[model samples]
Target: MGEAARYDVVQISDFRLPGGTTSSIAEEVRAQSEAGLSTALMHAAGSVTGYPIPWSTHIRRILDLPGVHVATPRDRLHATVLVIRHPTVIWSTPSTFDHVTADHVVIVVNHAAIDGAGTRHYDVEATDRRVRSLFGLDPIWAPIGPVVRGTVLQQTTEVPLRDEDWVNIFQMPEGAAERETFIGKKPVIGRHSRPQPGKWPDTKEDILAAYPNSPGYDVQILGGAKIARRKIGWIPDRWTVIPFGGEEPFDFLRRIDFWVYMHHPDLREAFGRAAMEALAAGCVAILPPYMKALFGDAALYAEPHEVLALVDEHWSSPEAFLAQSRRAQEFARSFSPQMHLRRLQELGVAVPETGATRQDEPAVAGTDAQAGASAGPQPTFVLNLDPQDLGLARELTRGLSATGSPVVMGLVADGAEKDPLGPDEIRLPGPPAFHLVEETGAGTWRRYITQRLRRLLADVGARRVVTVGTTIPEPVMEAFDGQAVEHHWVRPDDGSPLDVQLAVRMNAVSAIAADAAPETLAVTILKESTL
Candidate 1:
């Protein structure tokens, strides 16, 4: 037979394994590996030195999945560089896209859509633009279903049922066996999620009060120490509070007759993985009405106050509860790992039997050049320098100028009438072009600067612009108006001074000028400094 086809598929994310709630990203990686793909997981959270003293069992399960190569870079910047260098397809979460540049096809799994509350709202459209600006390509959006489905499939297969003696021959947890053996006697009600104040409903206390203090019913609040602590005094006589981890959460899920989720209605659920898990375990869920699109007929919708009444209605009628529970299980089955893999295939992610190109191959050069040529003249590097960043700005200008790229050095005056740069501060090996702006309040200055920068970029016929500073002012970004521009922040490493940061920025710019593809837009360099 011919040599096995070589290809690389990698998943990059902030959290590698399950922590409080199971990471759907990790589950997707596991699913890919099971489908005979050579997969690697680059943990963007960086390195873990020693074995975690108290690790979650769910995390351990993920670590043990077959054929998964895990890597932890020294920092996120290094991880981005590594991701760019290898792989035919790069899969990432929206939050993990900082400083990451993907020359290859990128598939973004959007787990959360709406961010911020009330007037400070940001939706998927803003996220899409940010990703496009960073990577220079619109990413294909994938749902979180496959990962959730995979979890349900694994749990259903791994956990033996009470009716199946042959399956129970394998050693199992006592709680798992107990869960399978115990049918509905007294109504068991619970909710599982990462404990965070924003996730709780405003009517949480009122919802809890609806559950009677009777012996016939049981209540469990799973996940998060803060939840346990806050509800300690308020917990009813038959209620138990369990922190997230081990087999207990899963056991509790198995025992739950009604899964009550009281997340604020204004907040988007982003696929609701925890709720899906509960549904898969045959727990009839009572969630907010806005989630109808996400859950379809799989869940029962109720407002916070209506939750207790809904639970009572279901508890009083076993047939009504069982019917909804069966619908939930059926809906959960649709999200299986196989379906996820199929979706990835549909989106042009290739599954090769053999490894592909070496990591050092020039991935971005040709594309960058073509994109630059089509846009306008050769690119210009602009540094919006504050007083402290002047030295670094000067160094970057010299570096980019050496590569035959035009450079503009701009000063951010601190609302002073005179120029921020004095004769002593103006020292440079070669004279470089410069611009000056007087900084004012956020509203006025942002508009003025953006307009000035836009004119400057247009006048220079700049095909691509790289902005270097402490931070790229939001106005500068808005000025680009979704044009091709990159942001490079001058940040020193721990214990390093301005000179060290200058060196790092110079090196990163040189690399981009040398290797960046024409299609490249924005890139942020250097790890964030603490001090």
Candidate 2:
């Protein structure tokens, strides 16, 4: 907001990524705007999982809306209501919200819950504790659905979580309202999620029992079948497989008669957005037993082995299927766009009588500080993190991030002299905030310096590299040279300014391999892979 405009609602979220949380937040902003509320939005710098949150088209459109302005860090903005979409931002970068007024109603919404805490997958209990501990603010804890709410309280950890039921803000897609019952001999059943193991059943048998590979059934899968390939060792030849983003979710949901979803035991789903959307689109959802608390009467819940029985029960009677489909749609509609407005109104927030107008088009994502910065490739800086050189590494990394160049700092073990005794050791001891990546696999000293470094650099899409503190070893340089990438070194003691010195060569680089976040998700994805 140019002149420090006050907002009725301010939402802070991972608008940096495309998925359930961002999509819901975008819709939330739209709903607020439509209800005559002035809304502002901000994106968290750190995501829960250190995943790549790209600047995609969908993200751009939401930020470009008429009433939805970026809540710039520079502005001392006030809000009647302040929303933190997930615990990720507030817990990681609490200072981002410092500009907003403290008098507003603060709501922290938890979208996902991990049972065990770690660096990547955040702990639910730990986050709840941290939010209460860090800010004197006793924020209303709003979990996305019953799953999240239940998951939080079920935890043995004692955190006074003022848990409130806040189902996801969702509705049927543009043309998904008029769906008829299936009457064919062969039925099509499917599931759409980010093809991860945690999103599927624990065992192949459990998976196959629910999502049958039998000849009589036609199975359609969106969000990739890589999990299927990894779990089953081969995707069933009978199934139709499409990667995530390959097709629209509603289109895939429409093609299927049933939405069958059963995840691993450890996965506290938090909320099933895809299934909710399917229900909105009039697909009969066959969910697990626990989901009954959230979806109630809308979706049939049974163990994986019992899913087909439920599917068959309705299949035998088209009228019954149609009736259940109607119930599903009816239930999903209860969480309509207006529900968001209703929730805010309950808290005594003033909402406008007239609706805000919507315009079509998208603008780039950024705050006031990033106003002039273009969204192109990110810049890679390899700081030599040897014990003696960490001071320079920290200074160099700090400056690179200031340039808004999507910095990727490498924390390599080969260069460090301290910890090599442990065969399977991983050292990520950090200079906080800056992400220092390194090659992960264990290897010999020779292989560590050459192949490992080359692989790590390639993953980050570093075609032109700048080494700070210590120059890359000759062997590593030679390996990169063969890959058609430029590796340049600068002495750490050089008095040159970081941003100014690199600007010219950085502009001149071929830009052939533009930097993007490394999708080093194969191993993790496989680890979570269930059928």
Candidate 3:
């Protein structure tokens, strides 16, 4: 197989798992690959511990990149650097990967906390020792940021975390074409995070202090205020409560004057990636005083009670507001992919000098960033799916993808999610390609719809909904942006003639692959329904 396809770098992480790790690693790989490097990304996030975390869409999208390979398990790869994020996988099972040989360095970037309170917390000292024993090379300990570093310092008698912070690598979304200092209207203040209970302060006063609905200010929260609403008891009259992912990250950041973030007192704010993204968007970010170590002058910090006065101070002077905004963007460069590439080189990875573009920070918002401003909302297709329909969903997704439009599929099942195929019946669906109908532990599949896919549908403006062999979930229905959406029900029974007919139409869909409009595909599917 052509000398087994050697690579310059091999990155391992549990990708099927969601959240920022996979996406951050993918961004780093993309940057390296763009600089004319052969990089291999592997999904080994839960492999060593025998957890069955599945492949994520990030890995799928990453695989499509020109020089990046999503390496399969046990695929022997030669590399100069073998970078692993949150390195519990190797620390537990030394044989988890016997194939990757890092000729120079093994950079262990920590994305998790050191405490074992969570299910997947990593021990920094243990990981460093283990990597040294396993590879005979002392691995570089790179904490994501001060928050992550704070945890590492709790027991720093063993390994010293380098001064260079391996903060979460992020690419800012399209920025607002015009930078307004909020002079004419009330200064808009907001924050974006998941609607989890731990994301907020303990009291209503503190919550309102951070997000005031005062007549002098406008509050726009992109993440749903479920916990905040529960704490406040009554929703604020003027606060524009947008469900998380209801709008693109940059779009929401653009509307706000300041990116105000405050976490629950009990939980430590470990490297606020969302806040960093805000800074990259040139939005003035205000966090609690503790975040000052990581953000410094790039963002502002104050206690809950002092937030508005800080805002008033900034608003009183347009020059100060613009200066803070510009400072935010400048500080965001420290976490860009170019900085990641430089970080990789510091650890002995021989990055090629051929790509001169490697010297410059990547342009986060350029002309293409302005496309979404004028381009009206794109159509989204939400495929209501069940475990029984994964094979069908997989096929349909292939056809839908060719249509050049976004698709949302929420196939997660509530309660006890057994495998779709019973022990006695194996022929229908076979071994599944996607994740389960249900996943136990922290990120339950039932919460998948409410937490993730629903917000994604909202963000993309899902206009057409299709349910095959099952009724749409009520939770999904509640989140659909009102009225414009069209819902269609396909054959209500699994393995019905509807499957055969639709499968044939989907197979024929390749013929119309050139048709990029989602409306075209929707028309074809509805036309086949009558027969």
Against the true structure, what is each candidate's TM-score?
0.50, 0.63, 0.62
lDDT of 1 by residue, 200-311 (tens): 6645464464344567678777874364336544546566767665345556788788888876545565467677777777888888886776788999988766877788
Q: What is the alpha-carbon lDDT of model 1 when measured against the actual structure?
A: 0.47
* lDDT against the true structure, each candidate: 0.47, 0.59, 0.60
Worst 10 residues of 2 by lDDT: 359-368
> Between which residue pairs do clashes occur in model 1?
5-354, 6-354, 6-355, 7-354, 364-517, 367-518, 368-517, 368-518, 369-518, 486-522
Query: How many clashes does each candidate structure show, in the order listed?
Result: 10, 1, 3
Error in Å for residue 351 of model 3: 3.0
lDDT of 2 by residue, 172-261 (tens): 678866566583567888888986777777778887888788998888888887876777778888888898989988877878898888
Error of 2 at 308 (Å): 1.7
Model 1 root-mean-square deviation: 18.8
